[model samples]
Target: MFNKILVGIDRSLISKKVFEVALSFATATGANLMLVQVLSDREEDYPQLPAYSYYPMWDDQTVRIYQQQWEEYKKQGIEILNNLAQQATEAGIATEFTQMSGSPERSICQIAYTWNADLIIVGNRGLTGIKEMVLGSVSNYVTHHAPCSVLIVRDTELLPPQSTSE
Candidate 1:
């Protein structure tokens, strides 16, 4: 029943499974697929600051360097999205893509709303407890906030072991 499907993608292990599921849906239903990748700048990705009490502002040169780095990061994200788009296209599915810079959860939900997507497909990292609290779960946020229906693909290997009756 889905006409427009938006898939949130990234360069993560779980993304492979997400793509497979989304692609299957798109191929089966002949739905238009839109793949989106958000280029986030997590604090852990940057270098740590020194032990100085007062933090100095970035100099003009430093600003330029950071800008250049962000540009490269965006380019890399575009490349990844393009590759995914190609795969979808090869499967005879109509596909488009976008690369955004922001929080993954917000970006994915915003795009799904703006694009009028009928469904959003995202991968859940299966983080729980303290880890989920600290890192925040993008799929969880999208499930709660997305305007349209959301499908969270969880990696089977990450799922907890099931109990078998004797």
Candidate 2:
């Protein structure tokens, strides 16, 4: 009975699983799916300066580099979201893709709540304990903070490999 479903995707191996599971569920329920990707603002990464610096002239070069990096990140993030939207369309599901600049978990949760999603699907670290902890799993955060129900699709749990012995 999910009317609005939100799936959080990132450039990771687990994202494919998230996409599949979210798409299937949305299809089954005849729900509208929203794919959200976050691109952090580059300016946030650098320290803020209270006063303008002109003597050393280091600020201009630093700002230029940051701008370039941010542009690249934004471009890549948009391409990814566009592809995801296309894939969902190919699956005959209603979809919308968005690229926002903010914390990943915060952006996802905000969108889910704003859209009033019945369920939010995300990917786990594919049965890896150490990696999950070290990377600070986004799915874990979304599951805990989302306003609605959350489904975590672990890559390893999705489809087990066929027996080689056969």
Candidate 3:
């Protein structure tokens, strides 16, 4: 029986479905839920890539722009996490939230392990083949690396549509 459920969420279309599944499990087991969202800076994350490589030349303006964009992303992530936490609270589930900054897979797994989570609920974006290879799969990474059990909710919409003619 799960006593501590950690749910990783983002601005993805499948986030709502993922939350619903995690909420149901938490409610059934009376488990404490922890909602986590990662706010990563693309420039900082891939520092190996020179900033001037993406532009004609490196300039203060470019740095400022990148900093502003990163701040916006962080703010949006916090708002989403806050909303999710409020929803969970209203549903009578004991909940807390953390906004982390780093690789999604690493942050999620680290939090789960440090928090002593009994389970981790996450959504699979269903990337495959070339895309999966290029971008890597967060759910797959978590499944392999997490210290606790992981439940990856596949979005129903990701499936091929059924034919009406049938």
TM-score of each: 0.86, 0.75, 0.85
Q: lDDT values of the candidates?
A: 0.86, 0.79, 0.85
Tens-digit per-residue lDDT, 1-166, candidate 3: 9999999887787889999999999889999999998764322332232545475575787677777766777787788888888988998999999987788899999999999999999998888899889777889999999999999999887877888973
Cα RMSD for predicted model 3: 3.9
RMSD of each: 2.6, 5.9, 3.9
Maximum-TM-score candidate = 1
Q: Best to worst by TM-score, what's the order?
A: 1, 3, 2
**Which of the numbered candidates is closest to the native, going by highest lDDT?**
1
* Total backbone collisions for each predicted model: 0, 0, 0
Residue-level lDDT of model 2, residues 1-166, one tens digit each, is: 8999999877777888788888899889888889988764322333333355455765777777657876777788789888988988888889998887668878899999988999999876554467556656677789889999999887764456868873
> On residues 8-78, what C-alpha lDDT tens digit does candidate 1 reach at each position?
98877898889899999998899999999887644234322333423466566666666777777678778
Residue 98 miss distance in model 3 (angstroms): 1.1
lDDT of 3 at 82: 88
